[model samples]
Structure formats: structure tokens, C-alpha cells
Target: MTSSSSDRPLLGRRSLLGLGLGLGLGASFALAACGDPGQAGTGGSAAGGTLKWGWALPTSWDPVFSSAGWDVHSLSLVYAGLTKLDEQGTAVPALASAWKFSTDGTSVTFTLRPGLTFSDGSPLDAAAVKKSLDRGRTEAKSLVAPQLTSVREVSAPDAQTVLLELSRPDYQIPNLLAGKTGMIVNPKAFESDAAGLATRPAGAGPFTLTSYTQNAKAVLRRNPAYWDASAIKLENFEVHPLPDAATVVAGLQSGQFDVAQIPGSQVAAAKAAGLEVQVIPSLVVAVLDVNVEKAPFDNPKVVEALKFAIDREALLKTQLFGYGEVNHQPFPKGYVGYDPASADLYRYDPAKARALLTEAGHPDGVDLTLTTTAAQGLPEQLQAQLKEVGIRATIDVVPAAQATQIVYIQHAKALFTDQFAGRDSAAQAFQVLFGEQGLMNPGRRTPPELAAAVEQVSRTPLDSPEYPKVLRAATALAVRTMPNTFLYSVPRLLARRKSVSPVPAFTAVQRFEGVTAS
Candidate 1:
């Protein structure tokens, strides 16, 4: 039966109050109250000092339109996602207090918490939630809205209640919500043309955007009227964009920056300098993407040959400086439903590669161009490795700004790229890179089995008995197809000052709320 929108229940004042209290508790105590080391309750440990952080990308304040890496740090300070993943990679409630899924799993009901307000003192309720989501759906330029295609309709039963009707069952919906694209915004602050507001953003997070300068630095201050102001430690946060690795390392060592993201090669040096180094293994994989429709790669044998030619083990050890894990497929090892059996497909064999190349009508050798970006970690090393196996490779390094659209969007022939698959879920990773109409599916075609598996896995309930089995099979099939050659999973290295206490477990996400300056 098609459920009527009127069937949804109105959110109550008590429920909103409870939600407000819960949020207040979460913001104030979830990280510190857990009895973590170097952490204290309520008042900050640093006694109200400014903390500076650094990264390798320019600062962009727009959460919706901006795709820059450093911009995420700035946006995160102002915005909050509907849900967040815990250390174990499980999706937990964030903005939404709790949610209930229908038996068929086609619908989801979210009960809103009370007394939630935006940074600008505007009310945040079910109607506001609907407006924020609807804007993403209708806006073509929004990177986030595309991920919510499964959402057929959103209804507000009352001021604090939200009901979502999906076209199909989606167990990974929560993970999507935890992503940057799922950050909630005040409907009143949203502008259809967000270009002007990209410099200044408004949201309901622990911190507020105070000032920003593109490609230089961004400054954030504690929200005085924040729902949970007691939990915030440092009075202000300064995020500096230093694209150079040396500059980031120097900043962290000199104590100019309290926290910094250093390149993998610099991890050992930073650790030697007596800084707290938290090495979180990233879900990101460096891959050699081929345009299946384009010439040369159209031949399956050539694709197989290219896969066999590259040495993933050597790349992981030497090129990555042993900071990453060698992966045989898109899904990394240790992820839920990852198939150990699939490792055999990626075995290094130069002789077999030569044979495959000869069979693909390139007997002597194949001359192909390899396009990569300079900031992509180890593309040059990959090019040199490909050359040893009789393939003449020419490296074309493009700027990081234009690489995504030029390589993935434009379907450049042989591009070297890296993709960070945030969570360890097969459904989320597969959908992002290989689903029929996925954003990164440069091949632009889906295999029948892969399509069926993705659909089945997407509909499986989070707690279903068949969930793990179906996920394993789907991942195995994707590996065999070789849509993109999986190389390795990079390790995310964080250099933080020793005085900061209460560090959360290293997951794909790094949350600053849990941190307290001493």
C-alpha cells in the first residue's frame, strides 16, 4: 500500500526537549565523559586558548559547492551531519535522535529533537529539514543531492517530525548521511545561487565561522549560544592551508599548529620529533582507471595485461613508504564482507601480462599515455613501474583542481587517481565508484551481475541475516570485473600536540569535538 503522508506522526514538545538534552549531552560529554586519557569535564583543559590546525589544501567555507580538502575542515566546524559513524564504523544518531525503518524497509521515520536552532538563532525542525533536502534534490550543481536519489519524498508530520519515503530499501542511507554531503543546513540561510555565500557559511555546529580567506587561512570561534557550549575546549580554531609538505611539518614541530595532516613520507620524521602521531588507515585506494569504451582499453585482454603488469606489493612498500596496505580489489581487506579469495586475481605476473598483451593485438608493445595529478601521492612511481613490463607509458601530470573533471568526468583514457572510500561498507564504496549511474563510473556501463548484487545489497536490512553473505558475493564480482585496478589503501597520518587529551579511536573520520587542549 502507498502510505499516505498524513499517516506520519507529529513530533511532540517533550520529544524535542529530550532530543535537545541528548544533543547537549553528546556535544558536552560523549567524548570526554567516556573516561578517556588527558580529558576533563565541562571546562576546557587549555583554559581558553586558540588552536591552529594545518592541511595541504586551500580553505573553502562553502559546504555544498566546495570540493577542496582543506575546505572540509572549515565546513565541518559549522555544519553537522544527520548521523555519524562510531569507531567501529557503525552509523549512530547525530542530529536525528532516533529513526525507525518500515518492515519492508522502503520508508524511514526520523523523530526530531526539540529546541534545536541554527547558528543564526533560526529554528531547526522537520519543515526546515525537508526544505534543506529538497533543495539538494532540485539543484543540479549540488554534489550532495545526487547521493539522495533514493529518497522519493520527505514529509513533515509536525514541527519536529520527519518522515522519508524511499523508492527502495537502503541500509547504507545512514552512512551516506554521515558523509560530508549529508551535512544539514538552515533552510533560511540557503541561497539557490550559493556562489556568494561560499565564502561565509552558517550551520549548527560547536563552532561558528568568524572569518576566511581563500587559499590562505580560515578562523572559527566557539559559538557563545551553542546548545552545548560547556563541552568546547579551545576558544577559537585557526585552520591554515599549507599545500607544501615541508611547511606543514615545520608548523607542527614549531608548535605553531596543534594538529596537522602530514604526508606519509613525513610520518616517521614527525614521530621522531616527540609529537603524538595517530595513523589511521584510510579507505582511499590508488587505482589505474581505464576508459572501457575507448580504444586499446576496449580489449579485455589489454585490461587484464595492464592489471598484471603493475606490482602492488612493491608500490605499497617502496612508493607508499610502507604506510598503506596492498589491495587486490576496490574494497580493502578487513572491511566487512571483503573476500580474501579475491586476492588471487591481482597476483603479479609479468609473463602472463606479456601473453595477454600479445593476444590483444599488441605483440611488440602498446604505446599509451598515463594521465595523473601531482598531488595524487605516487603517480610518477606507478608510471615507472608500468614501463618495466614492455608498456611505453608517458606521464601527463595535470593540476589537482582540474583532474577530477578532466579524468573521471571527461573519461580520459588512462588516468592515475586515488579515491578515499570513507567507511568500510561494500555498499557505500561500490555505489560511489561502480553503481550503474555512479559519479566515478568512468566506464559508464554496469555489468548485469554487479547491478543485481548492488540492488540486493542496498535493500538488505542493517541487521538482516543475509546481509553479510550478499555483500561478500557482490564485492567478489566487482573485483573479477576489474572496472579499475585497485593498488593500495593509504594510511591517514595525524600529528597532534601532546597536550591535547581525549583522542577518539582512529576511524575513517577524525572529529575535533572529542579533543581537549591541556
Candidate 2:
């Protein structure tokens, strides 16, 4: 068949990618943008004016029902979470000030800040927090439901206290609540105008989303009524969908964008243009997931063989401009679940890949596709590397917004590349990536060994000395059995005008609460 976005697969539901480039919403967000924060753009200028930041626009503005994990950043502008994560991946205060776990370890209580109100002038009390979290677990088609399954019940003991009762002794609640699952929705808006919320803000966050234009920009103004309004340094905060690399750098130089997320490849270009750059070690990892129910890859030997074909170090060095670390497991280094044994399990060897492919009944060769987003040079390099080992991989580039729907939900592609925006907790990441309902698992079934190992992790307390061992055991089983292949851990390369101060670093998505300018 001809290689096109509409072409039939040489590899059915078992394979996906070809350089068949199509443009729409995905084209505008080649995931890079440019402009000097020194020059102001449009309605506002720099720090005290408007922080014209280039990042991404969310598929859904509402947190409870948002599809993509990266949407947490956009959603955070309008809604406040029960807790927020710090640079160390520890849960700190947001709306909830202090929390304590019960003596039995099965229950935990959160103390909400006194007199907090939503932007819509509704009280953000304990009952509202309970309702929001309950919807996270029970809402139809909720993306966060899987991450919150351990919590069997949620109740508000008093106006200021919210309690969660777990099915077991899971001690990762605080961390798990750091992102979308932990965001507290305003109950009044859901009751009055739920549909309106898809475009507007109701929650008590730092900024109230004023205007959102699709595939273009989200215009937000600081909320004067915010609980900690003084922390918001900018009068306005605008986020645009980062476009092509050239367009991004051009925009930055022209003062069209103040702060933009540029590719690692463009750091030198940005720096030479008199812009400032910061390479923050982030939890973002790229994964190659396969459908084990299909041919070639369906065989265990071939599955293992493909592992040898990936040159993680080379990919890191070439594609990332040496700004990333080679990783074989989902968890990045310093994470408790990061396993050294898993990292040492696989290495790049084309001859070994070829030998294993021949042994698995493919002496001639194997042809497949390597699907990815519009991240310019990486997919082509992967395609070249795979070809050397007799795996001719076509490149398929999907749009950022539609990736989760087409690959993970519909399972249309046999094997696809996924860029994971790391979760708040290890268990949360495991549930979302390896569980039956995990977004990464198109197979939708966890093996018995993996299930048992993960269960041991869930039952163990997060602070327990043995927690890391149990979590590692689960990760190790997944690495050996699952068809999902982890490539590397890459940092988010951010560039700003000299006027802007250094952006705060967080484990997962970034928040603009502390970003300031001269």
C-alpha cells in the first residue's frame, strides 16, 4: 500500500507511522515558539504587563474531563488543586493548607484554607472539595478516574476538613492529588452552567481564564479575588500554542512572544539571538508502545529483539542535543520507582536485533511504522536506526491534541510512540501507564505477575522503608513483559527574554505563580 495518513496498514492494528505529514491544529504546535520577552506584544508587554508565554492549548479547559496529561498546566490557570507539587515532587499547600493521615493509615484528612472563594464568588468549602474529588472518580469519561481508584470513599467531616478513606493503606494520596485528579471544581458552576465551564473559569485559581481561542492562544487576567493574589506578579498571563521552530525564534526576536518553549535543537539559536535559556530536568519520557496481540511483535522473541534496535544514548545525544539522559524504564532518575536494574537490562545492538529477528522467523527482514507527533528530527532518526536492524519503520506524525484519542483510546495504531507527561506519584504513573485502564496500555490488560507486584506497592505505605523495593519490583516486571519501550528522559528546554526571571521548576507540568520579571 502507498504510505499516506489514509493508507491501509502493512501492519494492521499492530503498527503505525509514516512521514505522511498532515497539518491543522497539530501544525501550529510543532511544539516550539519564539520572541523576546524584552519587547511587549499586543495588549500587554513584559512582566508587569502580560507574560506572553508560548506553551500549549488544552483539549478541554475543564480539569475533571481533560484528556491529555499536559493539560494540567492550562487547567491550573483556572482551577485550584487540593494540593500542589514542589520542585522535589513533594505535595505542598495550594487550597488545602495542612493534612494528616489517620493512625490506622487507611484515612487522611485535609484542612482547607479558611474563607477561600471561587472566581464566581462561591465558597470553596470542604463539601465542594469532596464533590469535586468524587466527580474525579465517578464522572463519565473522566481521565483521572483510574488514578483515584484506591480511594474508596470521600467525606467532609466539617466545613474546613475533607477526608479520604482508602481501600487499603495507600500513602501516596498527597502526591497523587497534585495534578488534574486533585483539582477542586466549583460546584455552583456545575449546577448553574456546566457547559459554560468548557470555555470559562469557575474555580478559585490565581488567574481567571478570560478568553480562549482554539489552536491560537488562551488569554487570562490575574484574579484580584484570588486567595494569594499578591503572588501573581503579572497583570496578564497568555499562553500560545508553540508553532514551528523558525516561527518561534522569529516571534521571540520580534517581541511577539516573551517566554516560549523551544526545542532542545533551538537552544543555541535562541541563545545567539541574545535570549536566555534554561534546561530544567523534567520527568517527560518518550515511549514506544506495541500491541502484543499482533504479528511479529506478538512473538516474545521479536518483542525482545526490537528492544535492542533502539539506541537510547545516540537518540539522546543527537535529537536532544545532549540535554537528556538515556533511560530504559518509565520512571526518571531520583524517582523512588526508578530502577537501576531495568536501565541495565537493554542496550543498543543492531546485530543482536537482527539475530533475534532471524530467530523469531523473520530472516529476510521486518517492516513497520514509527508514529510520533511533529517533533521535527527525532522520528526520522528513529526510522533510520530501526531500518539498520531490518525493521523498516515509516514515520506517522499525529497532532498533539488528537494523539490520546487516536492511539490510546481507539487503539487504531498497532505500535505508536508516546510522550508521557510524568504523573505526581509512582503508583499514579504505574496505574496510568501499566494498569488495564492505563492510557499507555492499548492492550488494556495487565499481566498477572505485574498486577500482583503493583498490588503489593499499593498496599505499602509511601513513607515505609520498603516502599521503594516493592515499587521497583513492579516496574521491573513491567519492563520485562510489557510491549511498551521507554527511550529516554529529556528536559523541557525553555527560553525567555533577558527581562524575565528564571522560571520555577516542578517535577511534572510548570506553574506561573512564581514567575517574575525585572
Candidate 3:
């Protein structure tokens, strides 16, 4: 059964430390309690030293302005969100000690933990929370704002209490609060120049931002006055950007790094070397984006032909090394609203693909230019497979730095890219990528049905059993329309030195509060 967002209770500042009493039980138990700040690092040995982490993307310290790269990991260290997800994807409290929903489900109220202060020794209260959230809404044109769009206003009823009034009854508001985009900041430190503060940050998380150099490295120091300092054992941490996969593997082998993100093909080799390998299935999917507003793709038959020509099963087994799940629908498995029956939309048949091409006036096959990036999983191999099917497909392998620009800015016709649906709600996924106002909408046109469905889902209450039904119907329509041919969800792989004692469970999002180097 899918887990509900409101099942878990919020953890207050003092109560979190009390949870540490259950540490050292076992790895399973340790991962389960990771959301509780007091219970964080219970199963790991305390080793006070620097921890070096490596990834392919460089660090962009600013949370609001930056979309991709290592900004999420960097901001995670310095800022805390109102709510956080546990191993099972349940929402638990972080900055807010406890929260509750009104009987109508249109509003939520949070009680703050007294004495909590920012890294710069500023008081963390209801007013500060309002400032941080307001900035994200105004500056970034944040996708996260939609979750709060229903919120009519935010008011501090008392010194410790915050109340949010919404225009509609919705249950996923707390889940949205748990996302990285919702991490809180101090008004005192950033009120002067919100845009300028992207380079320098001040928050009440476990770590403090010491220095950041664009495209180089991000350095962090443990917050000495952090409310949960006892749970954070690492004195210093460094995240270095290594764009080349080979270089990342070499760094791991040469002992230049303790933890590094290895490609799926290199997982076996890393395990053979006796490194602690943790592979977490990600919610990311590789899709072939067609410009619906342009000619050719504007025809549904051409889009249907493209969908059937590619074999999803082959991509899942060969390219992903059986580390992915086949998906024709936009919603991935484990999502609360997913319907397995939607897989019937696309069946692999090369003969049928050629027949459809003929029907579309391309007898032999269509000559199309396909664009993809090396950063996406198995793009080169996927390009070769498409060529075998009689489609005169030419692959344009662009650099990772230029890929987003080529797709979003340059408006390239047929590009390969990966998108993530961090929330289980289908409305959240659809509204972000396919909706008329969505940032990634290539067609630049919003389907009326999709727009109406998104509106319905947004207004539905969490306790209503029909919520899943509404999401399933909307997803089915989206898949049949072929907005972008849905692909398999990618797994997230994390490697750590075996000596590190405390490790959190690998879920949709990677949590670091419980990790410790022994």
C-alpha cells in the first residue's frame, strides 16, 4: 500500500535528540529513524574529520535561481525545509516542531521550536518563515509556489505559531513543503539583497556555507551552534565537481575521494573493489521530447510512430542494466496515484512502426534529426537502436553545459532529456512539464483537458479516496496523447567507504543527516 503524507508525526528540537537513544540498533532501524534529528547518526560511529563527496555536476549554491547541478546538495547542508521525507516517502517535520491541518483541509498551522537560531545568530520565527517563502515566490517563479498558491495568506497567530490560509482543500501541501525548494533562510542575512545572497547563504541547517567558487568546489563547515550539532559528526565536507565518469571512477580507486556517484555500468566494478555501494532507485525518466507546436510532431500519428519504434524493454535491460522499471505512463511505480494498467498504451512492434510511418506519408521511414546529451543515460546506444529501425536518425551529442540551452532556449526539435517527479502526485509532475505555463513545455500549448485535470487534482483533499482515481485518469490521457514518450525511471546510486557507520536509506531523495565517517 502507498504511504500517506500525514501518517508520521513532526519532530521538535528537543524531542529529536531524545530519539538518539534508539541508535546503534541496526542499519534498518537507523535508516527508519533518519527523519528524526535526534535519532540521526545513531548506528554510525563518531569520527570527527572532513568528508569529501564527489559528483559530475558543479555546485551552484543559490537555491532559487539555479535549477540543475549540485545546488540541492549544497543547499541541503545550510538550510532546513519545513517538512522532510522519511525512508518510505512519508512527510515528517524539520524546522517546524509540529503541524496540523484544519477540519476543512484548506489550512495548516505550525508551532515553531523556541530558541532556534540561524547560522548568523538571528532568531528563527514565524516572520522569518514568511520572508523566506515570499522571496522564493517572487524571485524564482518557483514551481513550488503552486503548492502554496492556494494559500491565501500567512499569519503569525502567536510568537511560536504560524497559520496558513488556503483557497482550496489539498493534502499534498506538506509534501511540497518537504522538497529542497522549500528550504528556509534567515531574513536578516538575505533581506538586503536576495539575489546577491545566492552566492553566500545563512540558514539554520546542520552545516554552514564557508566558501563557493563557480564550477570548481563547494566547501562547508559543521555549524558549531547548530541546534542538532551532536547528531552531525563531520567537521568539514567538500563536494567536488567531476564531469567525466572515468575521472570520478579513478578518483574513487586512487583513494582521492571517499564517496562518488558512479555510472550504472560501473556499479559491479565498484562493489568488486569492496566499497559500500548503495543504489537508490530515482524517480527520473529519459524522454524523447517532440516540439508539438512545430510541424510533423503536430500530427499525432507521427508521434505514435516514434513511440512504437523504440523498444522500452531493450532500453531498460541493456542500457540501464536492469536497474530501471519500464514505464509508458508519466507516473512511475510506487507513486500513490500510479495505475499499472496504463502500460498497454505502447507495445513494441517494429513492423507496426513502419506501417504507421507509411500511413503518415513516409513510406520507407522518416528522416529526422534527434538531439541528445552524453549526460543522459545511454544516449549513444539509443541513437544506434533508432537507426536500425529504418528511421534515418542523426544523433547530435551536445555537451552537458549546452544541453538545457539547446532544448529549452534554442527550442531544438526531437531532444532526449531526463525529468524527475519527486512527489507521488501525478498533478505535480504533469503541471510542471506539460501544463501551459510549465517551464519545460516544448509545445508551448496547453491541452484543455490536461489543464482542467490539473485544476481538479490541485483542489482535491488528501483524505478523499477519489484522489487516486482522478490522477490515474489524467495520466492515462497524457500517455495516450504522447506529450513525450515515457521511459523507465532511473535508480540513484550512492557509494560510501565501509568504515562509515551511519547511513540513511536511499529513497527518492538522498538524505545526509545520518551519515558519519568512522
Candidate 4:
């Protein structure tokens, strides 16, 4: 049964809110309350400035080679997607003025914004966009490749227009193009220096890479040639990946960082220090990936046992500090894809987990390793919870930069846990999380029933009144059948000085469009 539209924050394609996430979801708490998000952020200085941001750097500057999903946040600095998500996650025009689908929905056309140019002074026209998108879909190592499987061809109809031919009817294209999947790069730069993009980037974004140090810091200068350069207030922006909570607090207190991301535990500390804290809903979701090919998980009963073994509520309240809600599926509440049926599907029943383990031939217990990165913040708590059900889980902490390569690519462990930065479209999010050959699915096979349900969602248009209903059903199926299980939906917790405006945010990506002092 379909829930009331009120449960969803739907702003259709015609409006600013994309795929139903809302600007007014009662989100973004600041200093206990945010008077009006529309009002300029109060504490920051109200003039041209430089923002010293404490954020995790993405794996690579080149979107095609970037491995982590949250890398979209970092890539957005030097690269602008063809379209951007509004406060509600809707596909709003950025590089493109407008876009539309054909009568059959198998093809779409985008009208490029006039006079757009790359940061290096190259024309960012239809041909450049087609080239970049083609590279994303065709490049073997492109992490965004799974998101574009339905896209058969990319063509430039004219200097002002680009066309996409789909292998099937797909209305999710525009929203999918809103982030990393749609970010267009300068063709000349890549054609001449593809490898260099791992460190240096060239695009039509608000900023340009001035300097970069792997896993340390990156300095960027405002792009004078950006399409809406006049709207950009900061002259310089520097990003430091300080994943440590203590470091974030120290940086904020020392005035070394005007803006820094902190764990939910630091919310009170930030407020006590007179810093404005913006804790807003994000597309980020924490997920546990089980390698079905591995011994313990190879048995269906063992995988099912894990579903009941995890204590999601405890983790959310204790480890997460009650900042985010427990989630059974990848899509969070208030999203069009949220599935009510998935609620309480596997609610912390250790007895049931043990029974399933016994049925799976592990009469005594099961031994396994759970690999996680420090940035995930889900430490010993997860390990301790699993022990209750006779699942002896050894925890291995991997480096943030090497986690994906180690587990997803190397298959170094039987299980992995990390927070996935969500994609712009529900279809793309589903694909990356559940589809065959998905980065998260190292086992490389999606259960057929769940696959069919997801396929229907991909074909349905978000503007269709039935879109949410279809997506919800698919979400439920994913949780019920897939080895991957979601724990909770997390927000991007940030503390910023009164001198700088609250950093503009939606999902994992934060923008400095109007971050000048007030």
C-alpha cells in the first residue's frame, strides 16, 4: 500500500526539490534551532573571504577514476555536474538550462547554458559534455560505470544541445546526472593528460585546483571563468581531511578552520564553544557488505542470520549519538525510495540469528572478520553486538584511502562495513548498492527478484505519481534479499565559526556558493 504524500518530501521535476527530499524536512539544527534557513547564516563575517574547510578528501579528482561515492563532495569543488540537486534533491539546471525526454522516454536532450567555459578557458559545450559522459560510461575503471548501464549512446546534436540514447525507457537520467555521474570534464585536458586528473582537475566549476597533497590537503582558487562566477563569494578555498573528532575540535578552537565536519558526539562541544552547528540530513548511509563467495556467508542461512544479529537501534543511539535514524534499506526516510515495509524486518533477535546459524551447519558458532575504516566511526560496538549471536567477528581497521581498493577490489575480507555516500537518483543508488557487478557487491550477483523490482524503478519517471510507490517496493525487496544490510542514515555534521556563513549543504556534498561573511 502507498503511504500519504506527506510522508515524502516530494518536489517533482517541475519544482526545485528533486525526488521528494524537501528543503523544509525540519532538517538542519543550528545552535539548538535554526531560525530560518533562508536567512543568511548569522555568525560568519559578511564579506569576501577564504574558507578553510576540514573535510575528507575524495580518492581522486577525476570523477571517472574516483572510487568512493562521497567523493562527489570533493569533486564538486573543481568539477561541476551537468545538473545540480536543489535543496530537495531535484535535478536543477546548472551547466544546462533545461532538459526533456522524448515521447517514448528512451532518449533525452539537454540544452546547455550559453557561453559556459572550463576553468582553463576551453568551451564547455555539447561536444565536451558528450566526450566526458562517454568516457564515464566506457572507461573500464570508472566507478560511475554501473550508474550508466542503461545509457547506450551519448551524442551532441548541436553546440547548445546534447542527447542521450537509452537502452531502455529511463526517466532517472536527469537526476542521475546531477552529481558525480554527470560531472563533465574538459576534453582537451583529459585527452592530453588523463592520468594527471588524479591530482590536477580541469572543469567548469566554482573553483580550480591550485595545489594538492594526497590524503592531506588541497588548495583551490575561485574560477573567474565559472558560469555564475559573479555569484561566487569566496576567492580561495582550502580543504583538509581531518577525520579525527579531536582534530576537528582543535582546528575549530584554534581558528585554523572556519568550517569543520565533526562526529555527532561533538555537537554539544561545538555549541559550548559558540560555534554554529549545522546537522542536516545527508544521502550518506551506513551499510555492511557480506561476501557471498566467502565461507560463512556462502550459506544462505548465515547471511540471513546476520540480518537479525545487528542491533541497529543501539548503534544509532549510542555510536551515532541519536543524530540519525535507523534504516533497513539504502534510501532514508522522507525520500521517495523509502520503504515502510522494510521497517522492523530484522529487529535485533539474537536467538533467531543463532538458530539460523545452527540450521546452516554451524551448530556451535561462526568465525568471520568485519573490515571497517576509521572514518566510518562504527568501532567495537558492532563487533560486540555480533558476539551475542555466536558470530565471532574480528575487526580490522583499514585506511580510508585504501579501504575500497582493499575490500571491494582486492576481496581481502569476508565482510566490510562503511558509510556509502548516496547517488543523486534512486535508480543509480540502487544500482551501485545492489546491481550485479556493483562495487559494494563483491560477490557480483544480484538476487533475481530484487533485480527485477529495481529494474522497474529505473524505467519509471520520478515525476510520475507512481514513481515513489515503485521505488518503495524495490527498496523493501533489496533489504529482504540482499546480503548487504543498512544500519542507519547519517547526516553531515558540521561546526562553523560565526565569521563564515553556514556552508550550503544537501547530502554528502557541501557548496560554498554564497559562503561570504554576513
Whose lDDT is greatest here? 4
Two-way TM-score contest, 1 vs 2, winner: 2
Off by over 4 Å in 2: 1-47, 373-376, 396-403
Candidate 2 local Cα displacement, residue 428, angstroms:
1.7
Name the better of 3 and 4 by lDDT. Answer: 4
In TM-score terms, candidate 2 sits at 0.87
Clashing residue pairs, backbone N/CA/C < 3 A, model 1:
16-114
Off by over 4 Å in 4: 1-47, 374-379, 397-402
Q: Total clashes, candidate 2?
A: 15
Q: Give a tens-digit lDDT track for model 4, residues 1-518.
A: 11111122332111001111112222221111111212222213233668888876766778887655556777888888777777667777788887878878899888887777787767789999999999999887676676788899999989999999999988778778877788898999789989767767778787878777665678787777666666678877888876577667767878888888898889998889989999888777788888898988989999999989999999999877999998877767777777888877888899999999999999898999888766344758888888998999888877754666677677667888766666777777776677786667777779888888878977776677888888889888888778887888888788998998767766535677777753
Question: Per-residue lDDT of 309-414 in model 3, one digit per residue for the tens?
Answer: 7788888888767787888865567765566778756777778777877888878777766676553456655666666666776677776556665666566655
**Local accuracy of candidate 2 as per-residue lDDT tens digits, 407-494:** 7768777677767756777777776678887767777778988988888876766566787788888889989888888888878788
TM-score for each prediction?
A: 0.86, 0.87, 0.85, 0.87
lDDT (0 to 1) per candidate: 0.64, 0.73, 0.62, 0.75
lDDT of 4: 0.75
* Candidate rank order under lDDT: 4, 2, 1, 3
Question: How many clashes in each structure?
Answer: 1, 15, 4, 13
Q: TM-score of predicted model 1?
A: 0.86
